[model samples]
Target: MATLDESERYRILSDERRRLVLEILAERTTGIGLDDLAQAVTTRQTTGTDVGPGTVDRVRIALHHKHLPMLDESGVLSYESEVRQVEQPRVASERHA
Candidate 1:
């Protein structure tokens, strides 16, 4: 596995959705959910071109297969569940259910 540094981080941050991911993560002190991450990226105004909120296929699947694992592997983020995301909010919901 490759080690991550500021340069790699910046490289990852350059992509639109990936940049959004970094922005969202930077906004929070703790980790956010995978779905929340996708939602945060895609959600937009009524008239705007929403790139995601799209087939739900790209964001959801890419998030699971690529983004999440990349973040975790790069030591940028951490979580338990891959299928549903394991943020504090989701964990609470899981507990209450």
Candidate 2:
């Protein structure tokens, strides 16, 4: 796992979407699929708004192309890009501790 300096950690967590992703992952006991994660994020983000498939798709694409990779590289989470799965890394628990 890679080490993140304070500035890097702040940068990674600065985005509302990424913070939401971490929050969701913290509540899960197992890995979440990219599709499911996207839906969850979209639902949380758009609380009362009428959400469309396009909205979810846009979120999914951003997560896949940007956020997930950033989190994975920061050792904050484990992202299996090929399988489109996201899991909180074991090291993340220790880091938090």
> Per-residue alpha-carbon lDDT of model 2 for 4-91, expressed as tens digits?
8999989998999999999999899999999999999999999999999999999999999999999998888999999999987876
**Model 1: colliding residue pairs:** none
Worst 10 residues of 1 by lDDT: 86-95
| CA lDDT, candidate 1, residue 15 | 62
Name the best candidate (by lDDT).
Answer: 2
Estimate the TM-score of every prediction. 0.60, 0.89
Locate the minimum summed-lDDT window of 10 residues in model 2: 88-97
lDDT of model 1, residue 21: 68
Off by over 4 Å in 2: 1-3, 92-97
Candidate 1, after superposition: displacement of residue 39 in Å?
Answer: 1.0
The residue-by-residue lDDT of candidate 1 on 29-67, one tens digit each, is 776666777677665222275454464556766767776
Q: Count the backbone clashes (under 3 Å) in each candidate.
A: 0, 0
